[model samples]
Target: GHEHSLTGHKQRGTVLLRKMEISVAEADKRTGKNTVNMQETYTVYLIETRPAESVPEGGTPAAPDTLWRRYSEFELLRTYLLVTYPYIIIPPLPEKRAEFVWHKLSADNLDPDFVERRRVGLENFLLRVASHPVLSNDKIVFLFLTEVMNNLEYFIFFPETQIIALKIQTRFISAVFSRRFMGLKHYSDELNTIILQLLRVRARVADRVYGVYKVHGNYGRVFSEWSAIEKEMGDGLQSAGHHMDTYAAAIDDILEEEEHYADQLKEYLFYTDSVRSVCRKHELIQYELEMAAQDLTYKKQQKEELATGAVRIFSLKGMTSKLFGQESQEQREGRIAALEQSIQEGEEAIKEKDAECQEFVQKAWTDIERFKEQKDKDLREALISYAIMQISMCKKGIQVWSNAKECFNKM
Candidate 1:
């Protein structure tokens, strides 16, 4: 049990050193290099401030008869230093009461370098506060003074100062104010102020330490709340980074799809242009076919008119020959021979025109039929190509949609 108690005390001492606002070298110097073994001999130098009030058997508060007196400034300062100073320092000064007066003097407009001077002066002061043997030990007053000093420490950079002011404020508030909701009739406003001020000081101190270390390249510990805040900011940034990545991918996909669509559109335009050119040529062919048909009909009409004129001339020739009355056999034979030759030549002329007209009609119809067949074939091919293009476009659209859905799910 003694060994365990010694181990616990060593652990506490180590922890206290670790918590100080000092360098490792400074902590080592303050605590010394002595090994904290269970069997080690150590001397305790504490000066008891006061005796604790005796409580009843049931742990009840003492009656009004057990009166407790208040403390004087010198005695209070001495007691307060022993208690509150440890909260700030590592392996705190054994007798720090004399240092409190120096801190108070420094706060009252002493030289800026007084803090260094006080550090030196304290070496002698601790011995005096410790060796003094006439001081009363009032534990209650000391405990109250410790709390008062801690509260005052927010506004005053000192080991201990006018801590009684804070206690007076607390007493004043408690005496006049009562909170029914909290069931707190004696709660101190001065204590609340200390808590609020401490929180504010913690934040300010953290910022100062961080700023100084960053600028001068020095040392300090991180505030407890800083890690939590930094973690939250990191999470937010990671989330934003993911969103940006998804957006970039979507943009890339859209650009690729647009390029593909542009390619398909270019192909479709080429095919449409080709079909339009073919259709233009087919239209020209149809026009030529109509003109050929008109030319053939005109030629047929001219042939009919020529055949009618030949028949009229033949009739006139026969009438004239009859009216003239040929008496000699030689003259009549020559006239008959000439008339037969003219009639043969007229029939040959008619046959030749009819053949030529038939040829024109056949050629015109053949050309028109060939043009119509070629045009129909071209139109069928164009329709088939257009249908195929539409099917391909639909399939591409479906593929793009599926790809987009997949990308979205991955996101």
Candidate 2:
């Protein structure tokens, strides 16, 4: 998640943010301050934090912070962020992994090195979210950075039902959804590219298969005609050099040709069916891609008509300012933060969709390659059988002609 969003930033030299250090330690077992009683000692990571904005006294906000959080706390924070920002593509957390080792009971999952690695990963995850223009202003994220997360509760709590109505405004939702919808359309183009490629490959393979089928059909026709001739001449030769042995030998040659023609027909039919089956499977994927594209386009167009800005009365200092409804600096920053979040979320979503489309196409191509290999083997086997039968039939024809000549000499 972080990779897609930042890879471009790194390349463009747009990634310049202050770094935060993270360190982990065994939780103090002696501190009898467990709100939720635990059976065993756990670990926690200490995060470096800074104030959200300037202070009135021009001092750093809450220096020497108490921003220590455990793994479960991190999980809780992630869950809250997902619920709160359904429109944003939040960065992923490190997996809780259990690794095994032979002969020795592996405790690597709880090992210091392992915990340190996880801490670093978690810290980076937060940093990525913080660097995002919109996610940086998220209240949950602020708590993750500023306070010791002791209270296991909701990230954004509403005082009442009325507050809930005010917390997520209609305009805010419209802005987020609009950006997300546009992001989907932006990435759907890549899926379209993949579908086109698959079609081209299918077409090319069909052309070659059809060409082979035509040749094999003609060969089969020749064999059928020879078979008919042999059947008609079964027990007699109508010509002056007529002989019953010559008719029997012709039947043997026709039998050999039957094997050759059967093998050809088998290959032809197999390839034709294979082409249809492969195309049919991929066509379903194509349909899904097209539908996803259509859905994104429709959603984007619907929301694009809505206003993309947040508006609220922002006066907080003076009575006169409040009466005039003058915009406060904090309010302006909040609006800017909202806009920035939408833009960043949209970009992250686009990146995610692009990656998914690429992966899907890559898997399809891999499957196609495997299918081609299998079909190639089948084709090779068919050709080899035909070749072997043809050679045997040729030898039989030579021997039969020799006997026929002897018979003619005797006559």
Candidate 3:
């Protein structure tokens, strides 16, 4: 069913990343079907949106709008988008509960570091959606970015008419240009396995790396104490200790930066599910078409048997007919008429399902191609960045030790 658009405008806009402010508020929780419990201490993000810099000629640029959105709301928006556009690879949201967190760090959702990471992730999600060629034009996305709402429940409940029209147009285009395309089921399954394994191994490696850097802190402490008792080597030992301390302290910042790359990998990991969903939807349509064709074939066989007055096979209907006496001529004619009507309906259903399947496959394959290009570009950049960061960290470690060595040589 078509629904009224909240805002009539469908113009694409830009989402700006503004600083997130933590607000403590009482949230009403539904403990049961009719129960309302007050939950305290929830985090909300301050999102800002503005008209794109390249506004059309003679068009007035709208002032930036700021709205306080909760993390759960972001989850809601993502869920809505996934259901609405199953073919498109929707941007993944950050992990709501911090996983594989350092032992020293607070694992709580409201932890400052965790919240900050989530804020960055949420910002990226918005930017990705805004930049999507098709998603950017969606009214729901536009409303999510620009509209101020006291209650978010009302926001997604209404389906926009523009979206219905878009779907209709998409179906028509798909039907005209439809062709057989390879399914992503096998590809997505393999990719998911590889990504999960990588994430697991990377997590273990990161944990060990964290411990190794932190162990340097002990070396720094030991050197400082040794310097206090030394005569000729005191200054040199102290300088070396300082470098050790600096290297140890740098781990926190370095690891935090590395988390960003992990997030990028996680995005594609989540994307595998979306790709599989398209394949599953297509399978369902294919199944329906098969069922319809099978039903039609049975009806045709029944019509042939009635017309030929064929001897009864060992069947429940045939046995009943024998016991009650053969069906009258009018009864037989009526049965044939019913079967003929059913056959016609079944044929029509088969055609409709086949067309629907073709259209879906075409549309889904088109988006998959687009997503593949994007995935290649994004993963390439992410891997390059990760390599560079590792190189830079190693260089810094070398520089620290080299400086420590020079200090000892001067002594």
| Candidate closest to the true structure, highest lDDT | 3
Candidate 3 clash total?
A: 0
On residues 174-263, what C-alpha lDDT tens digit does candidate 3 reach at each position? 212212333366778888888778777767777887887888888899989999999999999998999989999998887777777777
Note the Cα lDDT for every prediction shown: 0.33, 0.46, 0.70
**lDDT tens readout by residue for model 2, 1-411:** 111123322232212223332223223222334557755556666666543332447655455344567777777776566444433444556546522111122346666544644555565566556555456666566666666545757555534643343333322332212232344334434434543454345335434533443454444354445445665542222221233234333543343333233322332333333333223333333444555555555444333422332223332434555578766667756655665566556556556665655554465345445434543554465546556755764575566456546643543
Ranking by TM-score: 3, 2, 1
- Superposed Cα RMSD, model 1: 54.0
| Better candidate number, 1 or 3, judged by lDDT | 3
lDDT tens string, model 1, 4-123?
012222232332222211110101001223335435322211121222334447886433222121112333444354333211111112122222221112332123233223222222
Error of 2 at 87 (Å): 1.7
Compared to the true structure, candidate 2 yields what TM-score? 0.32
lDDT of candidate 1?
0.33
Residue 63 lDDT in candidate 3: 50
Considering TM-score, which of the candidate structures 1 and 2 is the better prediction for this target? Answer: 2
Q: How do the predictions measure up, each by TM-score? A: 0.21, 0.32, 0.81
Residue 201 C-alpha lDDT in model 2: 50
TM-score of model 3 (CA atoms): 0.81
* Model 1 clashing residue pairs (backbone): 49-137, 49-138, 50-137, 50-138, 50-139
